[model samples]
Target: MSPNLLLADESTGSKLRRNLLAVAGTLLLMTTYTVLVITQPTDLTGGLGQGVALATFAAYLLSALLLLAAVLRDLPVSTLTLIPVALGLNILLGQFVGSVMVPLYLDSIGTVLVGFLAGRRAGAATGVLGTLIWSLFAPTVLPFAAGAALIGFLAGTAARFGAVRRVYLAPIAGLVSGVLVGTISAPVAAFVFGGTSGVGTGAVVAAFRSMGDSLLSAVTKQALISDPGDKAIVFLIAAMLVYALPSRMYQSYEFVRRYRVLGNLSGERD
Candidate 1:
């Protein structure tokens, strides 16, 4: 059990209640937004296009901030400090990779890294917040915040299950995560954006469409083709980064210590 969870004081109960509320609220908001986009794409993009986008941005930001607040209480100050760097890394690499010739999007490396070191809540917060920040330059990404959050959540879950213990396991976990993410995000891309988000992914979708696939079908097929590879690469990179960290540094995280996330690397020197 986590030492933090062992606290029995009234304050701990209060904190727990508030944390649950925050997490629930974040999930509600993100889920509501995703549903709204999937069900009423025209409503969101019709007369109130920019306004709706701004509203979504605000809602997503609030969800992310609430999740971050809950995570802040659980994670150490040192671990919390890495979030901005991670967010920046997501945006920089996401944009750079999206614009390149590669079909993969390597945006969540930092989020996955945090998940490997911290836990799911922190990683999910990082993913949603990073996507929100990235949306500042690209408004189209606003609708996909839920998907981003899922990546981080999955990454943390993967780490908690010892996916990072072996280098090969990371990509395998990512491959599975990619299929799930792709299915979840396909509806949004198809309904809201006509099944194309980037040039490479768009090309894949177009190829699938040319083969007589419906809009959603083409997008799903494209996502399955691209997302698994993208996430596999992302997870492999994240696992490599975690392995590169000095044992002492990563060991400082309570999540790592409690879960033995690194799988008995005590003999390794800092």
Candidate 2:
């Protein structure tokens, strides 16, 4: 066997250490940013500022890229290449969805794809890091990175449980993930954007406000209406994509099993 294929190779161990260090550093940087915002709320309270922003642009940009790099560091060469494609798809789709007057976010397709094909760790990394990258230009997404990470983690986990293998259960996974995201996003929307997302849902929030619903209630309602259906579709799409992948692709991924959409269950690949 090639030295590279040996799990105990010293070079591989060193690479793992380096990646772990990077993750630690990234976390520290993000924690520092959070603390600064909390301790000195006025400085970084708002994502964008013309003067004296809470944190420097360099800090935000660096943390995002570093986390992304760390997440992709351990993947096989072929699988690693897909990360960029996924990120691009997500960003473009997310932007389009944001621009349109719709409450649904179809932006998680990339995250879901990677999550199902990889595993929870990689999936969560993709979600959190992808949202961080998006935050560079769209600061609003930063607060929801946690939600993204959770959804990705869950999607990958569902695959391990054979949900994706069964077409009927895939939508259930999506709906479950969406509800989880809504729980996290509600507070973020309420406090960060004050229940307005500049979309069709925003209008619903406005109506709720006029009807004397609390900001939290309005945002939560909007999420209830929009997130489940949108996330169900995202999961369904991801399942379909997984079904289309060749068997070789599954071999490259540690968490993904031999998946055949229509084949009888022969159990997971070793």
Candidate 3:
């Protein structure tokens, strides 16, 4: 093989290796936290699971760092620049909707957009980073960092499946994604926060709780109701925003080129 071909093969191999390690680390950490959260000791003040929770937090932070480092290795500088902008979009809209006590968490719009444009790693990184930043002010968001990363990962998966090719299909994908996300996040919400994550979501949970639903069941019911519509709206908005941008700008992304993420409007890569 030519030197160029050899180099390309080496680069691809390295990327694959990094991603696999990151995925494994993230999964391990996710499982650890999920298990701990679910089986939290009832006597925290007297220090039953406090040490374990602290250790888990450290492990979680380390895993996040590893994932971020691996995913960022191959991203172009231009794509990296968009992360902050996307994060801003996530925080502003999410915070506003949350502050107003809206049941929908439209926080992942930017995460979904990044995932659709840059592929899964970048998308996951964006979600993770945005969640960490949000946690600075909203401590409650800290535990859901994995959920945000999942949203970004799913957005990229949806784009890979051509969900973005048709405007309507994007929202449909989002709705389906919501079901999976909601189910995964329900355990955390129920056990950790006692089903009181957001004002609107809490109200729904309360309604279910009042109806004699178990804690987990009430939270899961509320998540099923809120997450699907929230994600659908987010997907539709991201799709519109993508199409609204100048084709030249979006077409330049390597992901858009490789995946034909923009469909016929993808244009030719320079």
Which candidate leads in TM-score?
3
Per-residue alpha-carbon lDDT of model 1 for 1-270, expressed as tens digits? 787777544477868876786777568665855665465444435666445555555565456566656655665566679888888888778778878856567988889888888888888878877877887888888767767878888999998888988889999999999998888777667655666867777888888889988777788888888889989999999899888888788877878877767788722343
TM-score of each: 0.77, 0.69, 0.81
Write down the TM-score for model 2.
0.69
Ranked by lDDT from best down, the candidates are 3, 1, 2
- Which ten contiguous residues of candidate 3 have the minimum total lDDT? 40-49
Q: If the candidates were sorted by their TM-score against the true structure, best first, what order would they fall in?
A: 3, 1, 2
Error of 1 at 261 (Å): 1.0
Please report, as a residue range, the 10-residue window in candidate 1 with the lowest summed lDDT.
36-45
What overall lDDT, based on C-alpha atoms, would model 2 receive against the true structure? 0.69
Look at candidate 3 and give me any clashing residue pairs: none
Candidate that scores best on lDDT? 3
Q: Kindly report which residue stretches of model 2 are placed more than 4 angstroms away from their true locations once superposed.
A: 1-79, 93-103, 258-270
Model 1 shows how many backbone clashes? Answer: 0
Cα lDDT listed for each candidate: 0.77, 0.69, 0.79
Number of clashes recorded per candidate: 0, 2, 0
